[model samples]
Target chain A: MDRSCVSSRRAFLAALAVAPLSFLVQPDKAWAADGQPITKPIPSTGEPLPVVGMGTWISFNVGGDPVARDARTDVLRAFFAAGGGMIDSSPMYGTAEAVVGSCLARLDRPEGLFSATKVWTSSTAEGLEQIATSERLWGLQRLDLLQVHNLLNWQGHLQTLSAMKADGTVRTIGVTTSHGRRHAELAQILETQPIDFVQLTYNIADRDVEARLLPLAAERGIAVIANRPFQGGSLIDRVKRHPLPGWAREIDCTDWSQVLLKFIVSHPAVTCAIPATSRVDHMEQNMAAARGDMPDAALRRRMAADVAAL
Target chain B: MDLLSYSLVDLIPFSRETYFRLFERYNIGVWPAPIIGLAMGLTALFTARRADGWVLRAPFLLTAACWIWVGWVFQIHWYAPLSWPGIYFGMGFVLQGVLMAVVLGWGPILGSPEATDRNHGPGLWILLFALALQPLLGLLSGRPWYGLEVFGSAPDPTALATLGLLLMIRHPLRWLLSIIPLAWCLISGATLWVLSVPTWPVMPLAVVLYLGVIVWPWVSGRSQLE
Candidate 1:
């Protein structure tokens, strides 16, 4: 190896050695206790949100099955117990919003619960009805955030969401896309629209947003919610076959999920990463990602490289 | 929205466990329906084997009843909540039931010599599989026996059995009757495949088998003589 490469490797290892001690001496101010999750400020309102939120895409769409609904309720219980905040869903996710409402009703609606869903209809009038249905399904008087799901008729829905936000029907309005679709259009919206948040897919394996979208969000003062932190669970499944990298210890990651999540929220613009899970153990592991030491810029690059190499 | 952009995983928004639990709940909620459905399926299988004139219409009527039952009771009431597409699926199934009744049961083709010829071939085997073996495929994945999907009550085996029944008959309108069942075979196959179920191939395999059975006699130059 080159002399400079060897010295850099040694310095990296040295940093890894004292990473946990650094957390104890000068912990990330966002995390108060040893195990409490870390929080990030929403750029639009300066409100603090835990970096790890829950996504209810498939996990909570259990329909009317009592067994499955109760199981999802357990997952949500574990989430709130672990200091989870945002619970993101969509009308497109069929029965998920209702299931969340059922679970919240079961839990009596926990404190610190931040409800986020989307409007996913083409007609502007239907979008308003859909939002009302979402509120009814979620059993909430007002939703904390509403996004134009997959940017379907975003032009019309954004106008409706903006009006809703203005009249205090909704707390925040935004737009979302997944599978890296339509970033160019999303960028145009970010530049022109007055939105509170812009959600897109971002993870260690998928980082196309870093080049432009993340920077644009940072510059435009928009909170960015990173979806598909696990590429809908395929990424973690693929990486789990390999051993956890030795440097994962530096960031207090016991499993590959935390390593992937920390890599996402460590980004300067990412406000939160929503990883969907049906199992309570997985939810607990997901929430744990928000605590302890976060990877720095150099370590973040290395983490991405190591995961990609895996 | 670009419908083609979505993958199978993106379309199916529930786990395999939840899917299996759907059948269990359906089977329990509609208690005597599964029993009646299986009995009707067996009667259809028996009547299909005889292939006697006018008597063959019994199978069509029985299978038609099964389709309507599964469509409304299972698909619309039970499965639609889990997947919004179930509403369309139920509509297709109900249409298939009505088509079978009007075309096969009441049409002039039931008494024709072509429709009466006994088809004790792959068609019988596939029907028997749908009735007796398809539900057992769930056992391979460690699903509970109560959750076993059966014909007349669940969509998968019901669709499969419909294809199998179509294969046994020889009429001009059989293709029209096969449309919804064939489409359902693909849809259910994709759903099971996305859920990572071990028995995912059963539905798609039925499609290939249905197509293969229809094409094989022609490929061997036997259809011309028939």
Candidate 2:
């Protein structure tokens, strides 16, 4: 049995058993590799949010690992460097809000941060606590936008959010649902409730939002933040193996990511398209969607048909 | 179970990158753990077919060690802080380790490989492949070499080695030993599948292999013949 080998290995293992954790070291800040800014106003407040913003869904839920935290810092650097704002997160995303805070704390430039997060709980009290916790986690004195996540206990939470807005704890109040869930209810709420914004999933493949929700938001003068613009990265993977269409250049889309992103933001009702990404290169690609020649109503139809065909 | 309330909001709160980074960080922090793990896996492979000897104890001992390492190092220390469900997973791995210990330490299970259903050739092959080729899965998936998941330090290979070891053991008790590893394969596999990982199918394949090894000898009357 190589007792000496076992003993030495055991010693090494014990040493490692107590070793300090390796958090992501801060990397050299990279410049945003894209051009220009595209701004759209919140219909209620008339406050402008760049059409290309950041979402912290799966991409930003990196827990407390410093290495992952530092990597996201670089992504944020690329985002803000490209004139991006209106970064969004949720309490349901585990430590994502905290990770976003950690990244923000390390960022050299955070003045343009339009911090947005959700109150994701079942009660008014819990929602209040969660909202306060989210603010603490994000290191913000006041949240820029607060939405009821997925409409879970939405009516109860909306009252709290409405109060928060009136009390100046949050600048904007809204409701959110994704994967096309609860659109009827969302549209009804937008009609009846005093919401400033509506966050929901809207992309090339998932177009149910186009018929009703988009039109309703426009009609009600509610700002729209489009999420899952890449359809949870699945749509990007679907078109990645195929070559970009020659017409993609007409919309200033360099890749399938931008092509998908530009399609969503091109909608006149969409105040912003928050495409979540961890890679700085992908961030640059997403931010570039804001600058290029946007697709017109006619070309947007062609973009949808092309991706649908693939 | 309410179909009306069902939605696609993920129960697991981390992304695929975060999950992979957990393995990467675990493997990196342990440094030479994989080197020692390979030796332990090879030790299990060489000693698995032995009947009524000290050598027969190697596989279970190594399996228990791997399970405990995954329990404490990977699940508890690494994953638990990330999500609340990881605490349950950590406890599950520790429970598996304790169960293996009870079976190996006190019961008439140690060094008692029965001849009834043992297939030395395939058993050795499965054990070696889990220890050797399984670690390369990270590299094949375009991750760096440091992302290699090894038997003594990772969940998938440890569960796989447990199955391979069970293949050389006797009936009823062998069935008992297969429960945890098989259950983990199904669970971990589903999680990976949801995360869109390529190796997701491998767990279900392992479950099929384990079921075949356990049931084939009985159905064919090979156990009666022995």
Candidate 3:
């Protein structure tokens, strides 16, 4: 079997979801890239975040000059204009938080920003110190949500965050695990802790989370933020060859990326799916995922069955 | 999920002054290890003779997280006051400078302890010397080298030499140093495309450069270096 073929299939299936917005956003920067309303209310706060969030995780972490800084700022402006609310970053992402803060400083801060980030390191004290660093770098008076990055120092950080949330230093606290490495442990943390959010690897190709993590999060009332939404560009590699299917028009995905994002968001339990894109064009394409009528349950199941076939 | 429009192709240059702005800040020190790491891994994939092999393949992906962590911690060394462990002798001066760069640009040589000596060209030695001397200067000054950092700059000859090697590197050495810029440009280009609105005319230049890296050595009639 050609595994890359499956990648292509997954890519095509993923693209099926975003076909329509290309009609609007593809031609020029004038079309808004973001502006979709929330698909799920925060179970803890019941506040609806625009399903589209800016992921500065790796995209904005470059530096050495103003070009680096200004480009990031423009993307941030587009994100705000397009109705994006969540901005997820981490100290692990290098200069992202600082750059993101600098960009936001230039913009009129968007309303309902669920500013989220993670503390990633092994030591509890170190993690605490890093979280402080993250806040200072991002220029946050208060973080809307904070998570133990990738379960690093999760238990120790949980205690620290729980206390901070209690004292109002942070608005909410959660734990995260990506790369699909720490699922068993992450599952335990979600089962045990009162975390408001849980970040993990989930995409059309990665449905392992669906088996247990998704069901658990919905049951526990914990929100899920899917990272590696494009599987770090692997998903795109898969779809480059396959054109959108003739049947794909029913769902409206012009490009392969929108289709992938829509499929993930179509899930009943997903709170939000955070995908990082450096290109303003990609950002507009991704934000369009929020506006349309997502596939119903039956379609989602069909979408899944077809991709898994390969 | 939010829909973002645009890819690397559509860029609008902010201004000419924007070009000069590159030197105004002390930023080369800041590296996005994830993207850099991804580039490193992908390059390794392109270089590898084999396409499918799990024996060592997954480790390449896993290294992304490790390199990123090291990148994060390295920031503390380069940006913070050099102290115990460092600040203790207070260590963390120019000499510890090696640690600062080590955490960030350690590259393909990472975890392969055997390759360390080979990766060091005539240039790396100068960097090592500067790394050792900077801290001594800091100690003599009674301040952390990073604390009293003038330009947040390093004047290491070795690093300069290595960089010089990069301007025209080929063969095994080219293979090694090329990863640095390859990772740097992609990460920076992606950042620019995603974050800022710039008239970036560099992608085509980048593609050309990438092609040059692959074709130049062969076409130079120096493929014999292989």
Q: How many steric overlaps are in each model, in order?
A: 0, 3, 65
Query: Candidate 3 - CAPRI tier?
Result: incorrect
Ranking of all candidate structures by their TM-score, best first: 1, 2, 3
TM-score of chain A of 2: 0.88
lDDT by residue for model 1 over A140-159, one digit each (tens)? 99999999999889999988
DockQ for model 2 equals: 0.23
Model 3, residue A52: C-alpha shift (Å): 2.2
lDDT of 2 by residue, A1-310 (tens): 0001122233234324422210110001101223436555566665556788999877787766678888999999888888889899998776788888988989953877898899877777888888889989999889999998888888899989888888998998999988888888888898999998899999999999889888888878788899998878888888999999988987667898988887887787777899989899999988888764677678889988988898
Looking only at chain A, give the TM-score of model 3 against the true structure: 0.86
Best-first order by DockQ:
1, 2, 3
List pairs with backbone clashes in candidate 1: none
The C-alpha stretches of model 1 lying farther than 4 A from their native spots are A1-30
Alpha-carbon deviation at A163 in model 1, angstroms? 0.7
Error of 2 at A1 (Å): 79
DockQ pick, better of 1 and 2: 1
Is candidate 1 or 3 superior in DockQ? 1
Query: Which sections of candidate 3 miss by over 4 Å?
Result: A1-36, A308-310, B1-226
| Candidate achieving the largest DockQ | 1
lDDT of each: 0.84, 0.77, 0.55
RMSD to native, candidate 1: 6.7
In the order shown, the candidates' DockQ scores are 0.57, 0.23, 0.06
